[model samples]
Target: MAQIPSPYWPKGVPRALCLPQVPLTHYLQVAAERFPNKPAVIFCGSTLSYAALLARVEALAGYLTQRLGVQHGDRVLLMSQNCPQYMAAYYGIMRAGAVVVPVNAMCTREEIRYYMQDSGARVAMVAQELLPQVMPLLQSGEGDALQAVLVHAYSEGLPAQPASDEVPDVVLAPRQWADAPGLHGLEDAIAQALPAPADHPGSHDLCVLPYTSGTTGHPKGCMHTHATVLASNMASQVWRGLHMDSVFLAVAPLFHMLGMQGGLNVPVTLGATVVMMPRWHAAAAARLIEHHRVSTWAAPPAMLIDFFSNPAASERDLSSLTVLSGGGAAMPETVANLLQTRFGIAYNEAYGMTETASFLLGNPLARGKRQCLGVVTPGVDARIVDPQTLRELPVGEVGELVARGAQLMRGYWRNEQANQSSFFELDGQTFFRTGDLASVDEEGYFFMRDRLKRMVNVSGFKVWPAEVENTLYEHPAVHEACIIAVPDAKRGENVMALLVLKPDFKGQVSEQDIIDWSRERMAVYKTPRIVRFMDSLPKSGTGKILWRQLQEQEHARLATSPAQEIP
Candidate 1:
């Protein structure tokens, strides 16, 4: 089927983009050549010019190739919070003709090990603060291919004396580490200035492998090539009207696809300045925006809520902001109204997944709808189809959303079964199943209704219940566990675990005990906020847990009860 022309498409924007067929590093090289002195990254008042950033990227690429023997198509794991070192490491890995496997900094030791082993990463670059989580993996002498670890401190990105009181204390501390065999400091790697091997990766070569959790309880990696990543990078730059002068506030985690594209990749592609934040602190964010004159920010609803709630936000001069957009969960209508009526800024909500580079559908800046996922972006063909029959649904009918576009990943890395289930042929075009239930309106805007996948949206983070349930099963007292989503006033939804304790340990294990156990075993966002003990859990004839049934009963119970503290 031909692309459906949406009447709601942004005016004057092309229906299709003529993207350059080259490696992603080409953009960085071009920017460095054109604007050598321009500030490429700004962190805690410290600036890294285009020339300096590119030089560091080249040096790190050389270290990976020469010292670590990272060859073409090799996967290099990168684990860090948002910082300047992350930017260099990301581009450097790709520059060395290796694929970047970015893991969340909050990942537990086991979670980090899984990503390193699954991606077959021979080398990893981690943040200094997160070294404790990664050191065990290197010392375990496991059969995993991991050979070298390079660590960088977040403080390396901060100025000697913080430019403002808003800078986090963690970012002010100096790097402290005991040298170990096969462990290298990031500064030492850059100082080597070893010549990088020739860049051989083309547009079609794999560049990134970002993992996404599934109902099967294991995370699957999405294989994105330079071409696929560039498609979204260029599309977002054009769609959002970002340019060389735009100063973007980077608060979203770079490991996630949205932040990787909006906060890092797009800004680098345009040679725009990026004000990097180590973590999301409302007061710090407000201060940075005012001081740096940040013009664009791609933040989730949770951050937006926090920003407006902070008393400092009202006093700060955010008049420099021109674009405010993001999507993980829908923006609350009340908060959206506050942004428009008070600040004169529209929150342009977008929809995409790890499978798609970052953007597929986004609310047009000039004509955005409240809580809507906007229209299909350029070069994308999106449709709604019945989940069971796979038949196309009519407009305004809720169904699974699917799309085929240049920005879509090649496929799930090394998971043929997942790849087969995720993509299907319809009218001679292969469309990736989004696993989201949504409907398109007459004006071509899409509205999300629900999710077909067993996932929870806590703030902006995705928590797969199966993954959390798997972690809970590791508890000594848990006999069986079922995780469900509960409504949260602040964070759209939070995880709630319904657990059946073992007969011998039933009276011994408290709800708080189980919650404490889970925190150490998984990412914080995936930790169950509420826990309930159960004598027995309902199951199907095959003894499969009836999670959906329990979820419905819980929602029904909440509907009738008066509001009470959830904890």
Candidate 2:
């Protein structure tokens, strides 16, 4: 298997060879040293210079090491939205030689508990609003190993607020937030903290633990070492043409791989300015970009659609944008065309997951393509393999997309069975199975056809139906549950649930009632868009629901009906 060059490669771009075997923290240290006064993070109308950002990172790293007793290789959960605190704590954990485990702030208590137990995290840095969820875990004795919790308050850093009308009034009003037993304010800890002892980790030292949902019915931790994750960081920087001068818009949540790489990690690596927004508000985002003259923005299709649809879009000066890349879902062809023809902005699309740090395939920055995951990146060997036979498929034949890259995760943490099932050795290279049904063109560009994994793509968010089904089962009325993907013109696919109620509760609950119940128990994207009552769900002889049959039936129904708009 020879390495194939991408025909879509930007003319000036050189195929990436080996990245410098630098620790992930090395990026920030280098940037701060070279340009101490340069702005490393822009948040809430305030700028954290390289010197200031590094100082905060050093402080937090010191606090974790000295006060919290976070030793090398220890997993520290970071539960927060996209904000300055997320950035400081993220790199700080790695700087102290501890692993960073980022959990979605939107996660319910049950979901948070699972992540805490699975990762065996001993400490956490959480956003102020989310402290309520993370607090219960620490108090429950179930999290005995967890010693401390650091709270990141966005209200402290936000230049001004009422960021939007939906923001809670309590959240907007100020008060004296402080430290208590097992709880510490991040700001207070940083003030008294010291720079951690110089600890240079090996290329293989695990630095990040991001959980990804798998076929095994739960989210499994993806162990990424400094060296492995660095590959994607550096490659993304070069591939997207980021420089010290680039200003990034940080709208994507930092917990996700794409945002962690493009919005935070890459900027630190290049000493670029990252304008951080704690939440996604189209108007606020547009204003920040115009005010800061942002050069790069990494986002999903949903954000793009919303940002463009904003009436303020007509007034914003987005001419400073030079790079816009996204993954999780492809930008619709018409939308991409409109962007290029009307705004002169080339949307650089990429494909990656929690497994690959963030990149494995990406559309070239120069000759960008719509709806195509670009050619295999430098130092990556991607192939379309028959899902059943595990044999390579010819160009244009759809199959599971498997890839081996420098940034690939070491393996799913503590899940040997999943590790065995997800990775296979082919041509002497160990490739991670993407679970995506796709095809590669003769030019080496890959196009997605479908997902072999039971996951739905809602506005570029991966929603595991099994996880949703598990949550739905918690409802008292649900006797049996089957979650399936329904055709959604805007979301690409949305979750639709089939439920068999307890005989006594048959007419007790409404479809809207079940939908509301499920929403509170799981992530919003995982909530069912449509809930249908069923006397009994179609099942296999083994007692498993026949998900595929139902999925196909829904496709037929949708095919015959006129599609509805998302709004």
Cα RMSD for candidates in order: 11.0, 10.9
Tens digits of lDDT, candidate 2, 90-118? 98899888899988877888898888788
- Candidate 1 runs further than 4 Å off: 1-4, 454-567
Model 1's TM-score against the true structure: 0.82
Model 2 earns a TM-score of: 0.79
Off by over 4 Å in 2: 1-4, 143-145, 158-179, 454-567
lDDT of 1 by residue, 211-300 (tens): 985656699999999999999888888899989999999888899887899878899989999999888788888888999999999887
Q: What is the lDDT of candidate 1?
A: 0.86
Total clashing residue pairs per candidate? 0, 1
How many angstroms is residue 426 displaced in model 2 relative to the true structure, after the best TM-score fit? 0.9
Root-mean-square deviation of candidate 1: 11.0
